[model samples]
Target: MALTTDTLRIGINKITDQVDPMGAHLNELDGRLGDGDLGVTMVNGFKNIAAVSDDLPDDFGMACMDCAKAMTKVSGSSFGTLMGISLMAVAKQTKGQTEIEWDRLPDLLQAALDAMIARGGASIGDKTMLDSLTAVIAATTGKTSAQDALAAAAEAADGALIEFFDQPCKIGRARIFGDKTKGMDDPGMVAIKSMIDCFT
Candidate 1:
């Protein structure tokens, strides 16, 4: 199956439903290492994205850009900015397309990951959501169905969390905490995991 604007709308709704309830918890996690507004960023970002869902164009690339713009409108934090950048990267690749095949998801994700790395200056081993995205790209590379891709992505995201839980964050504000971040979850990674869970 292919993904279109309808898929985007449904995905946004699912993610918003899941993220709304976890906002406070996300904030609590960020509080230990950063400004503690990660949850606020996430909550507001998805809310804005949902608000524009119905208005998105038939072109999936343009629709993705609209979602990215909506995200940037609500948040200027590092995480939020990276999210926007990633969406824009995907937009560039899919521009004018009415739909994208599920098999192309890995390439789109890779584009997002590469853009985030270039713009955010975060490496794969940094114990951030980039690591999670990297894992998802690998896991979903050959999957050709939305259900299969989502399940693989969910497992990859969760695995990323477990793999990095004991490692110290190596970038952004969380990195400032050094060893204190070792046993703690990276708020960005957790945010990614939470959203991926909604799809599953």
Candidate 2:
């Protein structure tokens, strides 16, 4: 089935609900390496997105574009900017489409991933959100259905978090901590997993 604006809104709500309670934990995680406000930034951004979700256009791409704008507006952090950029990239690629097809999933995912990489200058193993996002793209590459793909993506993201626990931060403010970041799960990756889980 094609993804609709209503369905997208539902997914966003699920993600926000899942992340809301974890905000404090996420902030704690960030405190060990980077700015301790990651959780608040993410929660605020999603809250802003939710506020405008009801009035979004019926077109899926346009809705995504609006969400991107809302996210960037409410959260001026790097994480928020990356999220907005990813959504904007998805909007650009899916332009005019009211729904997405299974076959089109790879392209959409790639577009978002590429945008994040370009804008954030981070790659896999960088201990950033890109690590989990890259895993999601890889795991969902051969999947034929949204349910299967999203499940795979969620699992991949979870696994990435496990691996990230032993790795040191390589980019962003977290990198300054060096070895101190070792054994700590990257807050960005954790957030990615949480978001992906909502679709599973």
Candidate 3:
């Protein structure tokens, strides 16, 4: 039902250290279209996690709650709000568990996907972090290990980005680039995919 506290901590750390780099990737890819602050925002958001990492809930459900609160508190960006709400969804599903059953991870991830969709109002193939995250989730769902799953996710994210280039943005500033975004790949997708690549 929940992962160990240690895994949760690592997840938080991974977000902090990788979020910026991922943001950097997105900024480079879509900076001309957007505010170019995805990296800075994610970096700052994750940085704050380290300070309160010790306060992470002992169980997975509680941990999710804590994570959402922390992200909302630390980040003032669109992505942060989405991430926070996503975690809140996960927390809701995993309400009181100590270790997540590997088999249930897919459900957890799917729940998160639903949360983001509901909050951000972005559909699949939007070239946003959701695209990347969804791709990874699809690939990792039935895989045996986080490493293998993440590897699949990264590759999937890359492919998803390609698909996104053909569609005009429906939600954010990236919409301006529409046709010109043809080969650029969404920055958010790249960043999220890269982070999964590292963990995988």
Candidate 4:
């Protein structure tokens, strides 16, 4: 599907529906690691975004940016804020464009990565959302095929998550896992990657 405002809204909407379920799952796993609130946090962010869909801009990037601002205002959680930032970042890259072309998706994804990095401070393998996002970005950094790109994005996220097996957790609830987390992948990262897969 073309990345129009309505299409983007549908994308976020579908993902929004999954947010609570995904968040709950992530939180359950987090309880095994840290605060166990990551799921709740994500759900709250998406919930807020869902509430504002009626006001979304017609342009894809503008819509994303608008939603980002709305999420930032509506959400009180860290994950919520981060989501808004990433959305806005993608939107930022498309500010000058008349439309959201498939050709620009790579840059948009990278912009989200940049935003995530600048705002979240998570690294390449921090057992954070970055792992999934990084994998997606790296896989289709400049490739075409919005569908393939989205697919590659999800696949990369899964692959990046595998690193958690032996890699150390520097951020998120997994950081508290210590030894227990060694065998488990970061649930939030997994969900983020999984959720992104839906758009394809």
- Cα deviation of 137 in candidate 1 (Å)? 0.5
CA displacement after TM-score superposition, residue 168 of candidate 4 (Å): 2.2
What TM-score would candidate 1 get against the native? Answer: 0.97
Off by over 4 Å in 4: 73-77, 96-98
Superposed by TM-score, candidate 1 places the C-alpha of residue 148 at a distance from the truth, in angstroms, of 0.6
Q: Which run of 10 residues does model 3 get worst, by summed lDDT?
A: 21-30
Candidate 4 lDDT for residue 40? 75
* Candidate 2 C-alpha lDDT tens digits along 1-200: 77788878887788778667767778888787777888888889888898998998987889999999999986445888888999999899877888787757777878998999887898877888888877788888878787888888888998888878888999888888898888988888988887777666
Pairs that clash in candidate 4: 23-39
Tens digits of lDDT, candidate 3, 124-155: 86667787677767777787665665577768
Q: Which candidate is the best by lDDT?
A: 1
Overall lDDT per candidate, in order of appearance = 0.91, 0.83, 0.73, 0.72
Candidate 4 C-alpha error for residue 37, in Å? 1.5
Worst 10 residues of 1 by lDDT: 73-82
Candidate 3: residue pairs that collide: 2-99, 2-100, 3-100, 26-187
- Candidate 3 lDDT score at position 118: 82
Instruction: Assess the local accuracy of residue 139 in candidate 2 as a C-alpha lDDT between 0 and 100.
Output: 86
Give me the displacement of residue 76 in model 1, in angstroms. 4.4
